[model samples]
Target: MHSSPRIRTSVAATVLALAVVAPTAAMAMPTAPKAPVEAKKSTQNYKGLPSGVSKKKTLVIGLDGAAAAQINEKNTPNLAALVKNGMLAKSNLYANPMAPTVSGAGWSTIATGVWPDKHKVPDNSFANPNYAQYPDYLTRLEIARAQSSTLVVGTWSPIPQKVFGEKTDLRLAGGNDAGTTAKTVDYLKNGNPDSTFVHLDEIDGAGHSSGSSSAAYAKAHATADAQIGQILAAVDERKAKKSEDWMVVITADHGHTPGGGHGGSSTGERATFVIAQGKGIEAGSVRHDVKISDIAPTVLKHQGVRIEDEWQLDGQAAGTIKADDFDSLRPHLKTGVDETKPGTTTTGWTTTAPSGWSIDNSAMPAGGVTEWQGWSFATDEFWTNVDLNQGRETSVHNRNVFAVADSDEWDDKAHAAGQFDSTLISPSYKVRGGKTATLSFASNYRIDGPQSGEVFVSFDGGEPRLLKSYDKNFNGVETISIDVPKKAKKAKVSFRYTGTNSAFWTVDQVSLKK
Candidate 1:
């Protein structure tokens, strides 16, 4: 139904990670409503598919790590079959840019239909050692899916498992034998969940390990395809006997590069397809643009959840695309691009200005200097000396920007523009006389509301140059640039300092290209 993937140098490049946090007392116990498994036994061979509410059931098969490169009609006939009978395309699901593209963030967003910060399920580590937890919005649905209403089955990480444990009866646990398929079967025959989410992990794991095209990767695809066939068998069994408007959506959580990594900069890293089919949906539907964030929102709409206001997402209800609603979250691109690898690592070249600038992790003792081009702030706390803040003020600058992001941790301040700025601070960039370059950096400003940030440039000590500006009133536009004439080569671009410095933008890919 969607795809996800990212940056940086040896400095660990500020990964949007899931940090460990103890679960609250409420999360320690499971949230599913206790009921005998026998009560669901009498249902037909349909998961999330009730007897009469054909339109009530929605199934999302999350093909984690599946990308555009691995998809083929011949390789995945089962998915192709669904598309042939229904409509499917790319979709956006998350509103925040740093919603960690990994399994934890993407799946949690899918299950909850809310931003990672809102759901509070960052990754596996939060709940488990390997995975994280940030809380989840899918707890009740997991119950609904197990009852006569919905069923969720897939290869999921411990991240989601911790937030909504034992909520569904047909859960097949990810990383197990026939994990994705077994749960689909359980729902089809025993639970009949009205809304089901099926997932596959091997493909993504293989892609992360060996790229998406390696032999191991190919085998994973073929195997997952075979599994899709099995799932289709179960879904088709009901479609054949009844005039039901069953729908099947097949898509990947995120894509991978050719060398076993994703994120950062590359179209290949963002490239994944969506294929859908069923009643009330169009067949042979081909869409050109869809972000991975749109999948869960679409599914939730199909399930009759008022997702519009509950979730602050960038995705749209793609279910009606066949009916011609094309205005949805277009796409949010990676700020940096690495010309070498399939995934984005670095974009341009950058260095600290007025050399010998103080490089300290005072703000985040654990986190190093988070310098960027324009913005550097924190949310609830500043990393002034490696200490957390509930929103503190600290400032130091030598014409650099900085930021810190907990990708899967989609909490409050994480969505604003700056967790660091208290007042207007300006950054400065200068170009020699014959240089034309670009300045790009990864920042978690969290300024989705009314706020503004500006970029200032200087040339030969002349007047200042303002490359671009951001405010609570910032409009939607990717790859913004303010071209400096050749005479402006002596000009530089960066953010000026004013005040409010709780975080730093870990600067990278700062380049002055020809």
Candidate 2:
């Protein structure tokens, strides 16, 4: 019997996937963050606007789960416009392979200019509840303020609220309408201090849960773009009233996998954007090889504050511009799944309530709705498995046992039921902006029993639009156009199953073309 595939859990499965990476020897990563740049206290105890007719101001805007696949030029006109006008830094890092690559770790890296290991805030919940320094979601504001007069606004996380203190300017709201964009405006307008930051998380949330190509994903991009537009407008509004030197920095904590995950090993996670405008940013700038942690120091430099080199950060001021023109493109690196190791496959559909498991074609397992949405089982004794490369994760039902292997090839014993189960595998993919594309592939659903499967497409990885579903049609495996809209950054297709009972299916070698 053919062996089953390797199943994994969502980073979120880690309860704070953002903070954990599968532990490994600490790589001799990058540099450390310097001490917080100190602002020269106002000499006069005067209340109100003073200074040589206003000094330049610095601002930092962070987007969680923001990346090329999640939001691109075509879908996000405002952000795209910002890129066009400012410096665009396409490649950057937030965490190491050891880091879970989850939100907290990723954002913290951007915030403290340090890694998970250095910051000691690895996952969502760390050892012994310590509400001491830098807070987490659900904490109070005063907790985060004892050190600095920081202002933080967040959507799903309470860390910002805790870090900023009770008097801290922190707000929690919906992802859309007055989202991260609005919080930023308030910070810039009121708490316009030497250091200020606003976090946007919709992009990543939509992309990670929904495929990057789903309509939900598209909506997220559009919403974020609209909010970004407002942010730009706010900046401009301030500019109209009086010259406020504001340098806007935008970048993602980390990218996600085609399967809507980042914790797993994939080239996508290492991919993020670093676009900046105004003040020391230099217009029409384009830099490469910038990491998330580097933004802090870059902001410090722009404000003309000297930072102590004690923090030990990993990023450097990057790029070259029309005003920039200083940096170069970041290294193009893409890591593929280790095929030689235990892998997932949709070789057949489980039927007759196959004691093993059954899942949908979208790559979800058939067994027990993936407790917390995991990819594979911890053990293989009783679970039927399906695996694939970067798309919606395949699922398994009846598969309950769990086991850990150092490699990809799984060696476990499993029995089959008398009847056939039903299932289909669907995975998400990505495409560049302004392109008409095709997703072509070859798949086989072992069970011929009253079943129909097709490859469906979604805009930003939202819903599936039937590209072609079949009971037993393998279209010679040539190539087909996916017909993506003008504005598509992510694309996804799945072998949809319209059959009774749950079963497994097999699909391979899928690609997208313009």
- The model with the greatest TM-score is 1
User: In candidate 1, what residue range of length 10 has the lowest lDDT sum?
Assistant: 390-399
Write down the TM-score of every candidate.
0.52, 0.48
Give candidate 2 misplaced runs (Cα > 4 Å): 1-54, 70-73, 92-97, 126-150, 162-179, 186-194, 239-242, 280-282, 319-514
lDDT (Cα, tens digit) per residue for candidate 1, span 204-260: 667777886688787788788898788767766764336445556777755777888
lDDT of 2 by residue, 1-514 (tens): 0010111112211211111122222212222332344533234321221122234455566676677554567778877777777887664332332355566566666665544645565554443222233222112111212222334445544334322223332333323335456655654454444345666666666666775556876787788778777766766665333645667777777666666756543445655677777755556766533546566667655555444543344434443111111111112211112221223431111111112222342432333322112122232211222232321121111111211111112111121222222233333456766766766543434333344555666768466687765555331233567556777787655444443333334343345665
| Model 1 TM-score on a 0 to 1 scale | 0.52
Tell me how many clashing residue pairs each candidate has: 120, 106
